[model samples]
Target chain A: MSKNSSNPFTVPEGFFEEARSRAVAGASEVRRRRRNAGIALISGAAALAIVVAAGTMMRSRTAARLYDESAGWLASAEYDVFLANELIYENGMDY
Target chain B: MDRVDQRFEKIVQEYSEPLYWHIRRLVVSHEDAQDLLQDTLVTVYRKLWQLRDPSKEKAWLFRCATNVVNHFFRRKKRELGDRTLDEYLEQTLRDSEYVNYTEAAGVKLQKGLLTLTPQQRTVFTLRYYDELDYGEIARITGSKPETLKVSYHNAKEKLKKIIEEDE
Candidate 1:
């Protein structure tokens, strides 16, 4: 162990260049990360919109089906009552 | 693009080489050192606004770098099921390519450094390699100046003893 007073580490040639490149690369990487995050946000919004639209469409279809069925049932019920009244009138059973 | 961003880049360019060496000495591997240095700069970029007095940026940067190194060890510890930073230092000595201490003194000095606790190693590196004053180191390490002085004093004595023991 000789006089170990001076700094013991020695860097390679072009070390500064290498470090500079790293910082530049790091900055670019930051930009890339931000871009990816933005893309993720947009996709999330799109997914939410799709979910909302699908839910609305399903509700509309269900309401339409129920409306048609109820309308048909009402028409048949009205026809049945009319036939019963006519029969009563024809047979003279007015009571 | 803006003034702050411009200043940040200037800081990166100015400090990268020295910071790399500082990290290299501690981490003892090129890849790890490079990764840590970049991570440190990224943090600096994000947190430069916290630095109210721009003149004290160096100490702030060092503080950030130390935290990054500590964070790396913390992550590694969790991954390895509780490996200590001192143990990591001991294991990585064999992997350090930057240690060109083919000479006996350099080799002995490195061995002595590795033998120290993580805190002592950091204190020594800051004092000897970086030539930072105790007050500056205190600011970076968040330790009292008196405590840093004591640590530096003991670290120097231990290094000498270890080196001399080999002779």
Candidate 2:
């Protein structure tokens, strides 16, 4: 084994102490980054869940409205009024 | 402290010095070794849970340290293609705030080491200075023992030629 003096190189004094401090700091940083990553992953999953639920709800509601409109159109044989039944009313209720 | 935290602290305290020495030799810069060592420690912390067999901690730590050094050199090579490790040492000697081993013999030895490829240098240093066996080095470097033996032999021959040429 290479001795401290005879080796081609040597480190600065207090290197171990400095290394310990750096390791501690590094460990904390890793933990922090991991925590952030976990939070981001959870947030993404939650957002995706909300979006899927909203999409399903919207699809069902739109399907019911379309079914109602098409049925009325078939019964009345009026193309314009039948098409108007498919319209989603947000503010006005003329249809 | 938690069990994992306690284990981590113990690992940091026990392995940092040796790992620092190993890394400095590989990187050829104290500052870079310091940063790289910390980066390695962080990686170890992150992967602590993945260690199924805890008895291999020493080998695992050294392996991780070697990997960090390899990554550092890979990035450096990407940025500065075909640049030699001697050039890095010379630059450090010229402008470094704290490269202490600047003797002629030391520089000659280091430059002679630069004569080999980085993998050869690492393998030889682990064999010669660190006095590790081939099997241990193979595990640390993720290389076959036969390959490491060949590398070590070639490194020895090249180092001999370089030192002789320097003399």
Candidate 3:
């Protein structure tokens, strides 16, 4: 067990009022910063979600158009000779 | 004033000096101590809601103050400044006799305190200058009670030797 020091250090008078005011101000500042951070986080998340959704939609449309163009090209005369050749062979030497 | 307000006011009024003095001792300047004290109080104010028991508030505040001072010291180390008040006092006392017995005693104590590591200094100031119990000091410093006791003892013995050497 230890004894308390007889002469504990003393502070100058009237320091608490000053300290209290500063503290209140600091607390307010912290609260304000926290609120701002929350708002920024929410807005940032929303913006990211919007960008992702737009990107996904754009990618799907681009893919669908690519498929349509390829299908259209394959449906032309360039593909008919190959199919005709296959049929001639399958019909047992038909000309 | 309301109960909470009155109670806090009384606490601020009563403990302000000791806390300030403790801070001043740790930080070594009136201005730095003032800044740290404000920061400490602000933290206490924000966390006051967490303290369910009013009786523990004093200890809680002291603990917070200790942390605040430690943080200030670390910051200063990074910024690279002149020695704190403790250092300055130690240097001064080494040259001249204190003007009065009280100052002589204070200087004597301050010199030994200056020899401690920053963490040890924090423990010492909280225990001796602030008159906080080991448990309170532990709570404030985030150290186990036994560790704090060991730190406090080592600091005290060193201070005692330094003071005795001057005699």
lDDT of 1 by residue, B72-134 (tens): 877877877667666776666655665566654665677688877778888888888877888
* A-chain TM-score of every model: 0.66, 0.70, 0.72
Interface RMSD of each: 3.1, 3.1, 5.1
lDDT of 2 by residue, A21-58 (tens): 87887788877898899999999999999999999999
Q: Rate the local accuracy (lDDT) of all candidates.
A: 0.79, 0.79, 0.72
Q: Compared with the real two-chain complex, what DockQ does model 2 have?
A: 0.33
Model 3: fraction of the reference interface contacts it also forms: 0.23
- Ranking of all candidate structures by their TM-score, best first: 2, 1, 3
In model 1, the number of clashes is 0
For each candidate, report its DockQ versus the true two-chain complex.
0.26, 0.33, 0.14
Q: Write the per-residue lDDT of candidate 3 for residues B1-167, one digit (tens) a residue.
A: 44545555566667767777777777655567788888787777667768887777878888778878777767766665666645554544454321233555665576667789877998888877677898877777888999998998898888888877888
- Please state the Cα-based DockQ of model 3 relative to the true two-chain complex: 0.14
What is the Cα-based TM-score of model 2?
0.76
Off by over 4 Å in 2: A1-4, A8-13, A72-95, B1-3, B81-83, B90-108, B153-167
Give per-residue lDDT, candidate 2, residue B139: 84
Per-prediction backbone clash count = 0, 0, 1
Model 2: CAPRI class:
acceptable
> Candidate 3 at B124: error in angstroms?
4.0
Which model scores highest in TM-score?
A: 2
Ranking by lDDT: 2, 1, 3
Query: Candidate 3 at B7: error in angstroms?
Result: 11
